[model samples]
Target: MTDTGWTTERMPDMTEKTVVVTGANSGLGYEVTRALARKGATVVMACRRTNHAKTVKGRILTEVPDATLDVRELDLADRESIRSFAENFEADYDNLHVLCNNAGVMAIPRRETEDGYEMQFGVNHLGHFALTGLLFDRLLETPGETRVVTQSSGVHERGDINFEDLHGEQEYDKWDAYAQSKLANVLFAYELDRRLDEAGIDNVLSLACHPGYASTNLQRRGPEQEGSRIRLWMMRLANAVFAQSAERGALPMLYAATGEDVMGGEYVGPGGLMNMRGLPEIQPSSDRSYDEQMADRLWEISSDLTGVTYDFAQAKAADDD
Candidate 1:
C-alpha cells in the first residue's frame, strides 16, 4: 500500500501550451486530456484505436464545450507505429509543453506484444520508452516550460528488475512481470530527471505518478490463472471500499504535470487510506529503487534493446557550453 501525502492544490494555467497524451480514449488518460484542453492547451489525444479516440473526442467536447481536442492514431506497442506517430506529430506541432506517457496494459495472461517482448513489460515500459525517445526533441523545444509525466503504479513498490529474465522468457509470472515494468517506469523517470539536471536543462521536468487503487479496467485485466469466484469476490469487495473514480485517479499525473511545488524525480501519488484515494502529494520510493548501479545497468540494457540511447553526455555538454 502507498503512504504518500499529495493533493491538487496548485494547478498552472496553460493557455498556449500544446500537450500530447497517449491512450486518451478512456479512463485516466481521457480525464487528463479533457482537463488540459479545458485549461486552453491544445490537447492531442493519441490512441491505438482512432475510432475509440474519436468517440472520446465527442464525449470530451460535450463536457468541455470548447475543448481543443485533436485525436491522433498511435500504437505504442509497435515500434513502426510509434515512429509513424512521432513523425506525423512532429510535422504538425512545433512546440509541446507536456508529453504524458500514460498508455499501458496490465498483467494479461502469458502473451507477446507486436514486438515480441512480454506484453506487460513491452507495452507498459518499453513502448513508452521508445515513444519518449522519439519525441525528445519536441519536448525540448517547449521554449519555456516542458513537463513529461510517466504514469507509474503503486505495484512498483514491490518491483525489481530481473535482468537474467527481463523479458520473462525463461519463466513468466504475470504479476511479477507487471511489477518489473512499473518499477522500470520509476527508474526511467528518475534517470530522465538526473540526465536533465546534469544537462543543465531547466523548466523541463520528468515526474513519476501513480493513481493508487483507482477503480479502472486495469484490475480486471490482471493475471487471472483460474476463474476463482473467491478471488473475484474479494477483489470486488476490496475495490468497492478502496478504489476511487477515474477523475481522482488522474490527479497525481495531472498534479505532476501542473503542480507548482513539485520537484523533478519526485514520486507522486494519492494521500489517503494507504494511497488508495485522495489528492496528489510527494511520496517516498523503496530503498532498492535508489541503486544507481541498477538504474545505470537498466539504462544501458534498455538502450541496447530499443536502440534509443538518450545521449545525455551530449546534452550536458550542450547545456554547459
Candidate 2:
C-alpha cells in the first residue's frame, strides 16, 4: 500500500488510540489536537502554559462536543520541566499511540534556554528528543501500531549543523539556528526509523512532517514584533495571498500521524510553491538531511547534550535475541 497523497479518508481508526500533541494551544497544534479529539482519540495537549491550554481545551470540546482532551504543563526549554511532564504522563496513560513532537521556537532574539543551549535547538529538537525517549516504552506496548511524528520546516533547506558551535557559542544567526533545529528534527526521525527497522519492529514508525506557509501565530514571535514592522506588514499581505488556513497548514502533520501506509522517515509537506502552501504532499528530504555520518554524530551529540542516551545498536542486538 502506498500513501502517495493526503486526505482524511485513509485516517486510521482512532477509537482506541491515544495521541500526545505538544504546544496544542494554538495554530497547527491546536487544529491537529481538535481534529484528533473529534475523531475520538484521547489527546494530551502538552503545553508550557496551562492557562492558555485550558482555553484551547474548552474551545476544542465546545466545537467537538465529545472530544476527550487533557492538559499537561511542559516547558520545553527546561529539562526539569520536561522530565516532570514525562513522569506525569507515564503515570496517567497506559498506552500512548502517537506522539506529535510539534512545539517549537522560531527566530526569537538570542536568548538561552534554562539549560544554556540555543532556544531553538533546545526546545524544537532536544525537548522532543527527550520526550520521545521517555515515552518510548508506552508506545512500544501498544497493540500493533504506533508512531512518533516530528515536525520540521522548509527552512531546513538552508540548514547546516556546525558541530564546532552546536550551542551557537561563537556566532548566532536566528534563521540559521532555527533551520538547524528543523534539520535536527528530520535527522532524529530518520535515525529512529533506521533503528526501528534494524530492530525488526514493524509496529513502530518514526516520521517527519511540515506545516508549510500557514497563516498561524507561529510567526507572532518574529513578524509581530515592533522592530519587524516591515516584515509584519509583509506577513499580513503574504498571509492573505500565499498562506493557507491553520486547518490546512496542519494537514501534513495529520496525514503523517494517521495515514495508512505511512513509511518510516517519510517527509510530508505542502506541495505548492517552494512547499510554502498547498495540500499535503509526500516530499523528498534534503540531501543534507540524509547524511548518515552526520546523523550518527548528531544522535550521539544529542544523547550527550540531553543526557538521555539509548544505544539503538544495542537495542537491535537485544531484539535479535
Candidate 3:
C-alpha cells in the first residue's frame, strides 16, 4: 500500500513496455509521457491533432534522445476517431502495458461534442470509456500485469450525476458538468476494477488519479476560449499563486500508473492539504463515487451510449491462450 509520500523517482523500470497516453500534446499527459519515455517505455502520443502530437514527440525526443514515441491521431470527442485509434494500435502493437485516459476538458461554455453529448462528459468520460473498452483485449493479452490510469479531479466531491439529464439537455452549468465528468472518471475506474475482479481477471489494474491543483493550461484555456476576460485572468492569477507545476501535479498519475505498491481501484492524489499539492499518495474519493449501483448504472449507460461493451470473457480467453 503506497499510502502517502510517493514520488515518481520510485517508478519501476519500464524497459520494453508500451504505453498510450491521451492528450499527450500538453499538460499532465505530456509530463506522464515524458517520464515514461525516459524510463525506456515505448510511448504512443495519442492526440486530436497529429501535427501537435508530432511536435510534442519531437520535444520529448529532444529531452530524452533515446525515447521511443509514436504520434497518432485521436479525437476523443469523436467515437469514430477513438475506434480508429484503437484499431490502429492493435494492428501495430502486439501488447499494451498501460492506457492512460488523461485527456479532458475543464470548465467551459456548455458545448456538445460531435456525438451530441455534453463536452466535458463526452470527451473526459465517455470518450475514454469507449477507448478503454475497445483496447481492453490487448491489455489483457499482455504477458504481465497492465494498468489503466484515468484522470479524475478533487472537485468530484461536489459532483452529482443527473441520469435524467446525462447530456445536460435540460440545463447546463459549466462547473457542475466538469465536476460530474470527473466524478464519472472515478466511478468508471472503480467499477472497471470491480468488473475485472468479478471476471476473475487479475493481470489488468484500473486506477484513478488527480493532479491536485496543477498549473496547467487546462484551467486558463477553458475560460480564455469561452468565459469573460476577467475569468481568464482570475484563472491565471489563481494558478500562479496557488497551483503547483504540471510536473508536480502529474506525480499522482505517474505513481498510480507505475508504482508497484499501487493496486486496482485505488484513487491517488497529492498527499498535501486538501490533496491540493505535494507528493503522490493514495486518497479517498467521494461516497457517491463508490456507490456500486450508480457505478453499474453509469457503466450500462456508457456502454449503450458509446456502443462499446466490455467482452471480458473474450479478453480472458485471449490472455489464457
Largest TM-score belongs to which candidate?
A: 3
Candidate No. with top lDDT: 3
Model 1: runs farther than 4 Å from truth? 1-10, 223-234, 316-321
> Candidate 3: which stretches are off by over 4 Å?
1-3
What number of clashing residue pairs does each candidate have, in the order they appear? 4, 1, 0
Ranking of predictions according to lDDT: 3, 2, 1
Model 2 scores worst on lDDT over the 10 consecutive residues at 1-10
For model 2, state the Cα shift of residue 286 in Å. Answer: 0.6
Which has the better TM-score: candidate 1, or candidate 3? 3
Error of 2 at 51 (Å): 0.4
Can you write out model 2's per-residue Cα lDDT over 109-187, one digit (the tens) per residue? Answer: 7778899998899999999998898788778777678899999998888899889998788998888999999999999
What TM-score does structure 2 among the candidates reach?
0.94
Candidate 3 lDDT by residue in tens digits, 63-91: 99999999999999999999999999999
TM-score ranking, high to low? 3, 2, 1
Cα RMSDs, all models: 2.5, 2.3, 1.4
| Alpha-carbon lDDT of model 3 | 0.92
* Candidate 2 ranges with C-alpha deviation above 4 Å: 1-5, 224-226, 311-321
lDDT of 1: 0.83
TM-score of every model versus the real structure = 0.92, 0.94, 0.97
Output the lDDT of residue 181, model 1: 92
Model 3: clashing residue pairs? none
Give residue 59's error in model 2 in angstroms. Answer: 0.6
Q: Tally clashing residue pairs in candidate 3.
A: 0
